[model samples]
Target: MLLEKLRAEVLEANLELVRRGLVLYTFGNASGVDREQGLVVIKPSGVDYDDLRPEHMVVTDLNGKIVEGNLNPSSDLDTHTLLYREFPAIGAVVHTHSEYATSWAQAGLDIPALGTTHADYFYGPIPCTEPLTDEAIGGRYVHETGVAIVKRFAGIDPMAVPACLVAGHAPFVWGKTPDDAAHNAVVLEAVARMAIRTVQLNSLAGVSQSLLDRHYFRKHGANATYGQKS
Candidate 1:
């Protein structure tokens, strides 16, 4: 019963990515973990959004082995599995090649904490993890991707910063559930767009620390509502 719900949730969330224009063709994927069962539900490899259904979703164990479904799981399955195993608190993962965020990744620069909108979701600049080394990429690129994420945030709180850009790649976001992860993905793209526009308008402008703290506090601190009751 729970697995069924998670499958449906992951399927719908993947569609949300398409609806929000965060992904083109089948360049993105979403996954949700049923920790109780140690299984994950994710979009099938290369499946178009219009054709996706609950059953079309692939089920795999935390070890990334297929448990059920006709098609193979997404290529990012190993990366998702690694994150879930390492961060039990995370229930969902989203990966996307959205134009703006990917642009930042390719530049090998972090997304600055530029506006209140950016600080609402992230307390500081959204970081970009370094590219995986050739040796690590060959050994287990997906696993090493997770390692990169963990190392980048070794002493930091992952919850406080829920999204990251993979250097020379795309952005990946996580949350307590598929919905939250999808929401973060949308927010990430939006903020990335804003940041780029800000730079275009004035290349010398930078996000100030005072603004960042105020915005982060209002939305993330004890009094934070973000217009929604928690």
Candidate 2:
């Protein structure tokens, strides 16, 4: 039953990516981990959202091998698996070629922390990893993608920053579950859009450190608790 719930959540979140206009055709995918089952439920590779169904979601082990499914898992599975292995607390991951974020990635620019909306979720900027060399990009590319993200932000706190752009690629986000990860994807795209607009107005302008500190602390700091308490 728990596995079924995770599968359902993963399917629904994939559709939400389409609903938000964050993806074009079959450009994005979402996945949820069933930790007890030691498997991940993810969108099938190259499948259009209109054709996506609960049964179409593939089940795979942490190694990216399909454990159960008629279709193939997303090509980005290895990247997702690496993250899960490195961070047991993350139960969900989302990868999207969302327009605004991809624009920043194409330019090799980081998404600046621009407002309370951006700061509340990510304490600082959404980092864009340095471009991978041809050798690294050619071998075990997905795994190397994960390595780049970790190596780029080696000293930062992961929870405070849930997403990163893969240099010339798109954005990858992780959360406690696929639902949370999808939420981060949407938020990331929104902030990216804002940042792009802000740059148009004035490239030198950015969110003040004091405001970033206040917003992030009130929502995600040691003493912070969002939503209603249990």
Candidate 3:
């Protein structure tokens, strides 16, 4: 019961991925971290989303050892843990093979910021990480998966851009909370789909820096004015 609320939030976030068509079958996972407790709550591996429950969420230490739950933790648990450990601002992580976003990942291409929709959620283009080496893939694949993402963000701020594509894999998104991470995943897919079409129409199409800054700042940070104020 230590992470009960966090478990529920992670459960709901997982279901949101299914509801939004970002996940099919059991192809995705969602997790939330309790930084104060140094624990994480995540969906169990291979469990169908329709049957998932708050109690089914597996609790684990940041080192990826399970502390609670009867089921196995998600296969992507290491990726979540590494992100939480390295990026202190991220409280949740979501991995999904949503069509358009995964397509970009498989192609090892970034989703270009073609319009305000892309810029609104992502400060710039959604980056795709470099392909993993055979050594990395043959070893601790999951842990190295996290390392690749962290490397891709070497000079980037995780909060400013909350998502990335793993070459030949899928998309991983994070946020200040589990629900927020799931929301960003949805937006990533939407914009990814749009970007695909935009490029098809005009390969050189791109959003200007001024327009990107305006849309991104208006909805985020201290100066944000897009939604109802808390």
Error of model 1, residue 221, in angstroms: 4.4
Q: Which ten residues in a row have the lowest lDDT in candidate 2?
A: 221-230
Clashing pairs in 1: none
Off by over 4 Å in 3: none
lDDT of 2 by residue, 6-91 (tens): 78899989998989998998998999998887898889999989988788889999888888888989998988888888877788
- How much does candidate 3 score in TM-score? 0.98
- Which candidate gets the maximum TM-score versus the true structure? 3
**Which model, 2 or 3, shows the larger lDDT?**
3
- lDDT for 217 (candidate 2): 89
Model 1, span 1-230: residue lDDT tens: 33788998999899999999999998999999998889999899998899999988899899998888899889989889988988878889999999999999999888987778898888888889988899998998878888888777776677888988888888989998999999999999999999999989988766688988788877776877568674
TM-scores of all predicted structures: 0.92, 0.94, 0.98
Quote the lDDT for 63 in model 2: 81
* Model 2 misplaced regions, further than 4 Å: none
Clashes of each: 0, 0, 0
